[model samples]
Target: MARFSYRGRNAQGQEVSGDMEAGSADLVASQLGSQQIIPLSITETETLGARSFKFDQLFAPRKVELDELIIFSRQMYSLTKAGVPIIRAMRGLQGSARSPLLADILGKVGDELESGMSLAGALQQHPKVFGAMFINMIHVGENTGRLDKAFLQLSDYLNMERETRKRIKQATRYPMLVMIAMAVALGVVNFLVIPSFSAVFAKLGADLPWPTLVLIATSNFFVNYWWAILVVLTMGAVTVWQYVQTDEGALKWDRIRLRLPLIGPIFERIALGRFARTFAMMVSAGVPMIQVLGIVSRTVGNRHIGAGIEQMRNGVERGESLLRTAANTQMFSPLVLQMLAVGEETGAIDDLFEEVADFYDQEVDYDLRRLADAIEPILIVALGVMVLILALGVFLPVWELGSVVRS
Candidate 1:
C-alpha cells in the first residue's frame, strides 16, 4: 500500500487534511469520496534510494505563453478531432512544445494522468495558465465527452479576443503618434525657439504687439519654471494613480469614462463584446446560467456595465427571465434585448449571445476606424490653427518693428 497525503473539503464544507494508506491514489480518492470529502490534492509519499531534487519542478510556476497556449489549443483540438487518444495527443504536444514551461506542465499532466488523475484534475494543477473558467469548461467537456469541441471553441474565442485587441491598438496608433508629435513640436518651440525669439525682441527695445507679448510671457514662464512644471505634473500623476487605486474612485472614474462623448460608445461596445462572448462561451460549455452571468459580470472591464450585469444576475436569481432582466437593466441596446428575448423564447440563448458578440465586435472595429479618421482631420486642423496664430504673433510684431525703423 502507498502512503498518500490528501487535502479535501468535507461534507460540512470544512477543509480536512491527513495521510492514509491505500492501494493507489484512486483508492485513496475513492475512500475520501465515501467519506463525503472532495479531494483537492493527493500526493503519494515515496522513499527514494537517494535524496534527489529537480530545481525546475521546485520553482516552476505554471506559465504558458499566450501564443503557445493558442497554438497548443488549436493543435490539440485538431489531433483529438482526428481520433487521437487524449494521452497520446498530450504527449505529442509535450514533445513539440517550444516553451519549456508549457512542456514541463504537459509532462507533469501526463504523469498525473498515468497515476489515474482525470484530465480536468491534471489541468487544475496548472491554474496560472488555465483559470477557473477554462478548467470548468474542460471539466464540463470531459463529463459530456466533447473535449475536442470544447478546445476548438476556446481557441476560437481566444483568437477573436486577440484579433480585436490588435485592431484596437492599430486603430489608435496614428492618433497616438500624432499626439506625441504635437507634444514634441510644442516642447521644442517652448524651450528653444521661444527663448531665441524672446532675446531678439528684447534687444530690439520696441513695445511688442499684444499677441507677441502674451506669447513671450508664456514662454518666459515655462523657461524660468520648467522644474516646477515637471514637479507639478509628477505630483498630479501620482495623485491620480493613488485615487484610481481606491475602489470608490475607480468605480466613479469608470462610470465617468463610460459617459464621455465620442469615446463612450466605443468603450460600451468593447465591454458588450466581452460580456456577450464570455457569457455565450460559458453557456455553450454547459456552465450553469447563474455561474455564467457571475463570470461575465466580473470579466466586463467597465464597472457601470458590470454593475448592471450584477443587477441582471440578481433579477434572474429571483426567477426573472434573462431577457427580462437584461431589458430592465436599460444599459443594453434595444436590439440586443429583442434578440435576447427571441433567443430565450426559442431556447437558443447561447447562439443569440454569440451573434450579439460578433455584431458588437464588428461595430467596435468600425467605430475605432471612424474615430481614427475623425481624429486625424480634427487634430490636423487644430495644429494648423495653432501654428497660424503663432506665425501671426511672431511676424505681426516684426513687421511693425520694420515699419517703425523705416519711419
Candidate 2:
C-alpha cells in the first residue's frame, strides 16, 4: 500500500488534510467522501530513509459542460425512471463518456457511492461541475426519494436554456457576417485597389483631385501602419477583457448592457427567464423559498436585475409576499407580477414561476426576431452610406479633373 496526502473540505466547509494508505488517489478520495469530506487534492508521499520527498499532483476540477451535463442528466433520468440502479447507470455513462473530464467525474462518483457516500454528498464534492443550486436540488430530490423525476426536470430546463442560446446565436449570425464582410472589403479597397489607382493617377502628370488625394493618403496609411493599428486594437481588446474580469467592472458592464437600446429588452427577458426557471426548479425540488430567491438572484446575469431580486429576497424574509415584492420592484411586467401573485395565492408558486419562465422564453424569441429584422436594414444602410462616401471621395476628384481638361 502507498501512503497518500490529501486535502479536502468537510461538510461544515472546513479545510482538512491528512495522510492515508490507499491503493490509488481514487480510493483515497472515496474514503474521504465516506467521511463527508469532499476531496480537493491528493498526492503520493515517499520517504527515503531520513529524507522525506513529497510531490503534489492536483486532480483537475470536475467540470461537465452544459451540453455534456444536459445529455448526462437526460440519460440518467431515463435509466433511473426505468428502475436501473444508480451505480449501474453511472458505470454505463462512464464507459460511454467521450469527455475525459466527465468520465473521471462519473468514475469518482461511482467510487464514492460504493464507499457509502450519499449521491448528493458525492456531488457536493465537485462544486465546479454541479453548482450549489444543482446540488441543493439533488439533495432535496434525495430527501423526497424522487431523484429520477428531479433529474428529468433539470434536463428539460437545461435543454430549454441550450435552445435559447442557440437561437440567440443564430439571430446574431447575419449581423456578424455582414460586419466581417464589410471589414474585409474595406481593407482590400484601402490597401490594394486604391493604392494601385493612386500610383497610375500620379504618373498621368495631372494634379490629382482632393477626394482622390485623401483616399490615396488613407490607403498609404493603411498599407504602411496596418501592424501598428492591429497592435493597438489587440491591446485595447486585452485591456477591456482584463477590466471586465474585476468584480466591480463586470457588474458595471452588466448594468450598462442591460440598459442598451433594442438589446436591453432581450437581455432583460433572458435574465428573467433564467431567474424564473431556476427559482421554479429549486422550489419544485423542495428548496426553501428564501433560499430559492437568493439562488435566483445570483443567477440573473444582470446586476440590476440581481439587485432587484436581492431586495425582493429581503422582503420575502421579512414575511412580505413574493408577489408584492416583485410588483414593488417594477423590474417585471404587470402580467408577470399578477401571475406570480395568483400563484402565491393558489400556493403554486413553483408552477407559476415555470409558466413565467415559459412566457419570457417566448418573448425572448420574439425580441430576437424583431432585433434581427431591425438591425439588418440598419446595417445595410450604414454599409451603403460608407460605400457612397468612398465613391464620392474618389469620383469628385475625377470630375474636377474632367472640368480642368475641358477648360
Candidate 3:
C-alpha cells in the first residue's frame, strides 16, 4: 500500500486535506467521492527516504501518551452522551488535541468517518494509536449503541493503569536515585580520588597493605582501560536489547523479571491485576469469552503471563472450565482461584473478575507503600559497606606510614 496526500472540498464547500493509504490515486478519489468530497489533487507521498533513519525524529513526540488517551476518552464520553455526531466530534477534537500526531490522526479518522466507515473501522486504521482492545470495545459500543458507556469504561481503566504506574515509579524512585548516585561516586573515587592517594603512597615507599594495593591496582585498571570498559558495556546492552526483541528472548526475560528479588512479586501482582481488569472490561462489554482472553493476554504487560493466559484461552476453546484452566496455570493464588470458581458457578464472572482485580490492586498498593521502607535498610547496608571499604583502603596506609615514621 502507498500513502497519498489529497486536498478536497467537503459537502459544505470547506477545504479538507489529509493523507490516506490506498492502492492507487483512483482509489483515493473514489474514497473522497463517497464522502461527498470533490478531489482537487491526489499525489502519492514520497517513500524513497521514508525507510531511512532521521536524527530529528529521535526527539520528536511520536507517541500519544496515556494522559492524552484518558482525556480523549473522557471528552468522547461527554460528547457522545450529548448526542454529538461522531465526525464533528472528531474534527473538534483534532483542533483541540495537544499532540500534533494525535490531531493529525484524528483528522484522518474524521475523513474516514465522513466516507461512511464505522467509528471502529476508522480507528482501526491507526493501530499504533488505537490498540486492538480499543477498537474491539468501540466496535461493541457501536453495535450496542452504548458508545458513551464504552468510553467511560475505557477512561476508568486507563486511569487505574496510570495510577498503578505512578505508584510503582514513586516506590522505586528513591532506590533508583541511590543506585545511580552510588555508581557515580564509585567512578569518581576509582578514577580520581584513588589515583591521588596512590601517588602519595608510592612516594612514602613504605610496605603497602593489601587493601591499599588492591585499591591502587583497581584505580589503575579503570583509568587505563576506561574506553574498553565503555565499549564492552555498550555492546552488552545492544546485544541484550536485540535479544529482547525476539519472541523467545522476550518471554524468557519477562519471566525472569517476575522472579527478580525485592520487586518481583509486586510486578507479578501488577500484571495479574491488569489481566483481570482487562478481562472484566471486555467481558462486561459483551465480547466473547475466548476473544476476551485473547485481548487480555496481549494487554497483560508480561509476556510470560500473557502466554499463560493464551493457554487458558486455548483450554476454554477446547471446552474446559475457566477455573480449571486458571488453576492449571498455577499463576493465581488460591484465593483468586476460588474467586474464579465462584464466578464460574454464579455466571457473573465479569463482576468476580473486577473483584479479583481489586484484590490484586489492594495487595499491590500495600506493597508499593512499604517498598521503600523495605529497601532502605538493604541500601544502607550496601552504602555502609562501600564507605567502610574505601575508608580502610585509603586511611589504613596513612596510619601504617605514621607508625613507621614514629618508630
Q: How do all models score by TM-score?
A: 0.78, 0.82, 0.89
Better of 1 and 2 by lDDT: 2
Better of 1 and 2 by TM-score: 2
Q: List pairs with backbone clashes in candidate 1.
A: none
CA lDDT of every candidate? 0.82, 0.83, 0.90
Model 1, span 1-407: residue lDDT tens: 55678887877887767655566899888967855679999998853333477887687655676678789889988987899988888898999999888997898788756655567767865667876556766777788888898888878877876787788789889888988998888788878887798798788887888888878888889889999999999999999989988988788888888888777888888989989988988887788888888767766777778889999899989999888888888878899888998998898999999999989998998898898887888888989988987897789888978987898
Candidate 1 off by > 4 Å:
1-65, 82-95, 100-128
For residues 1-407, what per-residue lDDT tens digits would candidate 3 score against the true structure?
77888888888887777777777899889977865778999999955446678897688797999999999999999999999999999999999999988998899899877765678868876878888778888988998899999999989988998999999999999999999999999999998999998998888888888988888999999999999999999999999999999999999999999999878999999999989988998898898999889888888889999999999999999999999999999999999999999998999999999999999999999999999999999999999999998999989999999998999
Alpha-carbon lDDT of model 3: 0.90
Task: Show model 2 residue runs off by greater than 4 Å.
Answer: 1-65, 204-214
> What TM-score does candidate 2 reach?
0.82
Q: List clashing residue pairs in candidate 3.
A: none
Error of 3 at 59 (Å): 5.6
Q: Give the Å shift of residue 175 in candidate 2.
A: 1.2
What's the lDDT for residue 125 in model 3? Answer: 67
Best to worst by TM-score, what's the order? 3, 2, 1
Which pairs clash in the backbone of model 2?
none
